[model samples]
Target: MQGGLEFKTEIELLSRVHHKNLVSLMGFCFEKGEQILVYEYVSNGSLKDSLSGKSGIRLDWMRRLRVALGAASGLAYLHEFANPPIIHRDIKSNNILLDESLNAKVSDFGLSKPIVDSEGSYVITQVKGTMGYMDPEYYMTHKLTEKSDVYSFGVLMLELLTARKPIEHGKYIVREVQETMDQTKDLYNLHEFLDPAIGLGTTLKGLQKFVDLAMWCVKESGSDRPMMVEVVKEIENIMELVGVNLDANSTSISASYEETSKGNSPYPGYPYS
Candidate 1:
């Protein structure tokens, strides 16, 4: 899978996908038994870095919501807008890249598979994806569906809110969050699990709704999970409910992150990493 046909598969899949929220493939090199893919530079770095506080980019509540919306939009495009529908077998926080403007772009399509000639039909294939992010149903049934991606994205959504890996300390984020969450209290009584950087002291508007939608996406049954398109719509509604003006916040956030990152950025400033 390293230097052979997986490279070609990635190229084919990436070439067919074009979206602002998706990492764009510029070109590739295949010569002298070498394989190289050149992608557009995303200055900010991976979402994992930021969530782990390695990027020095402090994402507030609105910023996190925007990131969720952007990533969901990209997945929706792949699932619903692409020429042939695509199921991104891997949808982890490590594969989500952030730009200087804090926009989210889905990356690493090496495991992506196209669903051909049928609507809402699944492919019987080997289940391939990161542990804890893989859909439980797909893992048992070996039937790859677009909803499988939804299950993984739901885990990523939880990671965004909690700043924890899908699996940490022998625990899964989905179950941990579900058990800890109490809708009767503020912030769903998830103070211990929610990341402090997302402004828990202050109000997080539409957070309960966001958490509900994310939990829906992570439902045990694929049939019970909402589609990526529905995820995008609900995220948009959350942003609207919070009154996050997309155009205005981009500039302000850049400035704030710049000051925070001044002479102390944890990222190496790699142009193509």
Candidate 2:
């Protein structure tokens, strides 16, 4: 899936879009049936690595928030500002890379689609994406929309908090978080779910709001999800609440892409202002 048509598509799409939070395409080669795309070397590994403790980069709450903001800013630009607009069919933590500063850069555009170039609002096509991060609605009806990415991003948000894979040991993070969440208790009674490195029983400003927003994005239905632009605003507001500079940046717990898909899934208007 990373060569030929998909490879060229990735090259073309990356060539057209440029953003600080997006991995930059340096150059490429496609002669003699050989294909290569050279992108700016993002020093730090993927967000998945950091969260899994494989990258050895301790992610505190602020750094994690900044990483989330950077990824959201990149997606917002793709969904709103790209000339023809784009929908990243995959939005998992693995596709999010980090630079030396630990600022996130959205990578792996192999599955990106120009939402506006298609027939209209939503592009109807065979759904292709990572197992845990695929959108339930998209997987169901094959209608790829901006909100699909939102759903996947919601899962990524949960990954940030829990530092757990979307699905681990047959337990889906979305369902885990959904069942564990109890608004009546302190920290939503999510101490067990939260990554201890984020600190324990300490006053984590904006933690509740952050959890609420993540749940909102993962609503079972796409329409119930917030637009990427709206997500950016919410993150920015959360950052401000957490005392991070608003000037700087930027989940129901939908059923597993497995369970719902085994049973039962719009594009966006461009130039949202």
CA lDDT of every candidate: 0.83, 0.82
91-137: candidate 2 lDDT, tens digit per residue: 99989999999989999998889876446568887889987777777
Q: How would you encode candidate 1's per-residue C-alpha lDDT over 163-273 as one tens digit per residue? A: 998888888788778778899988898888899999988979999998999899978778889878778767877887898765654323323323432112123431111
What is the overall TM-score of model 2 with all chains considered together? Answer: 0.89
Best by lDDT: 1
Give the local distance difference test score of model 2. Answer: 0.82
- TM-score for each model: 0.88, 0.89
- List candidate 2 stretches off by more than 4 Å: 117-119, 247-273
**Candidate 1: global Cα-lDDT?**
0.83
